[model samples]
Target: MTTLRLSVLDQTPVGEDHTPDQALRASVDLARAAEDLGYTRYWAAEHHGSPGFASSAPEILAGALLAHTSRMRIGTGGVLLPRYEPAKVAEVFGVLASLYPGRVDLGIGRAGGPARDFPRRLADLRALLGEGGAVPHAPVPPQMWLLGAGRESARLAGLVGTEFAFGHFFSPVGGREAFEDYRERFRNATGRPAGGALAVRVVTADSAGRAEELARGLLLWRARKDLGEDAPLPSYETTRRHRWTGAELARAEVHRTALVSGAPEQVHAALTALAASHGVDELIVNTLTADPADRRRSYELLADAFALPPGGPETTVAHAARVPASVPAGR
Candidate 1:
């Protein structure tokens, strides 16, 4: 059987008035919980000027998560490469690798930086990796990965000598095609053996009914975000009030192509079939449930269904030292 790796994108409520410190602490706890559940990696995302997804500083968050866990590999689902100087990113990730040793990964994304600022950011990043830079006391050059929604990202990943990870779950191309495009380009670009791999994220649930119900909220939020609506803590009820039409619903459904929702045996069969058909090297499962308890349950259910052998620390609910009082539960 193909090995399945469970990973999480720690997202915080955007509209809520939570302090950054509180948000960081909560994210750390979540990562630790995922580690105890025998997850392979824990990742955070980069979002700017967005209230609904507050994890903008993935490097700092990666460091914190790394400090809190001993086994699980910590990384960014994607760092917005267009936003920061590549050198700074390299420096930051290098420091993290130094600190965490063999456990650091740097996942880069083409999104994040504003279009107006992209040129400068791209230039700086290139310069940093190109020439003279101060070496660290303990160098931690990260194993880089490129995350993109299209072919350009796949090509870039090949050029950069890093692993390619496509956002198949949220991208327009869906999973199988995206995986194929990435793998083909990776092989062509590097002229290396087909050993280099691709990783795709998906949302899987125990049942179609439950998955649909859970996906309703997630889909609605994504639709609203795509439309550039910035209401705070927007819920499914609010989305229903807006009345999404058939065309909009169809578009949303298209984006949901990678999602697998069924009974345990059914889900396992579907995922295994998907893996074989696509020649996917790694399957990164991203569950949609927001409630921490529900999220944990989802992980357990998946583990049982896949028959994943368990070998990790037991799950423990650590007392969050600084819970943000103003966090809006964006369920």
Candidate 2:
């Protein structure tokens, strides 16, 4: 078995009663804690016009996360490719790489939907970031990754020579085959070793029962999302109080299988098996809970379960460097 490497993919979810600002702050807190707990990378998600999610600008969020964490690599879980020009995306991440040097990544995707021209845009972005690409003016190029759910994206990532990340959390079907196709077709003209990561939804607690309880919001949220109900994540109480129809319950059940929730030991075993099946060493955890505390706790438990080596003592922040009260704590 390949040694497991864990990372985070935060969507900055806003709960029913929470504000987007609060959710952003929680993301920073989680990134810092995740770094101290030995997570290898922290990738912020981009969601457009969704009150349920707050991180519409992952590049900006990535900058904040990079400032807060000392060791972990920071990047966009993806900046939706079709929404912006490739040159602009390259330039943005170029500036980020200039600031953070080797600790920045540029993960691009199609905004969680199908796009006919994604492959071309992806190639264009890759060329601009390549050796003779548009980012030559910057100090260094950020690591590039293509985020996809199926074989087509996998093949594109391979042909274009960027790292491939599979969205197992949302598209669990054919994930194993996707990975196989990626590895077989990978061709890096730049000569970087072929790399891949699998992203999955996970929830963990001290007990299996508690984990299940914490995941109630996610099941409800998934069901709601499937039915075109675009609202903030529901609280545990909200999920419990809401009535569930048969179709909604069935939809939730279908999504439940994609979530790996249990005690740390149980979760670890499941994740390990999943990574093995996908033939990937890296696993990106995307935990969405109504309570931010539960989301934070989930990462802490996974880090310990995976035995990831924690970072050394945190460097002291000068008094003058402390964030002012007027500013959000996460910023």
Among these predictions, the greatest TM-score belongs to: 2
Please give the lDDT score for candidate 2.
0.81
What is the C-alpha lDDT profile of model 2 across 17-52, one tens digit per residue? Answer: 899999999999999998889887889999888878
TM-score of each: 0.75, 0.90
Task: State candidate 1's TM-score.
Answer: 0.75
lDDT of 1: 0.58
Q: Against the unseen true structure, what C-alpha lDDT does each candidate score?
A: 0.58, 0.81
| Stretches of candidate 1 exceeding 4 Å from the true structure | 12-24, 113-134, 137-140, 172-191, 194-208, 232-251, 311-331
Per-residue lDDT of model 1, residues 191-282, tens digit only: 55332233433344567666565566556656665667653443434544667767657756765665666555666777677666656645
lDDT of 2 at 38: 83
Task: Provide backbone clash counts, one per model.
Answer: 4, 0
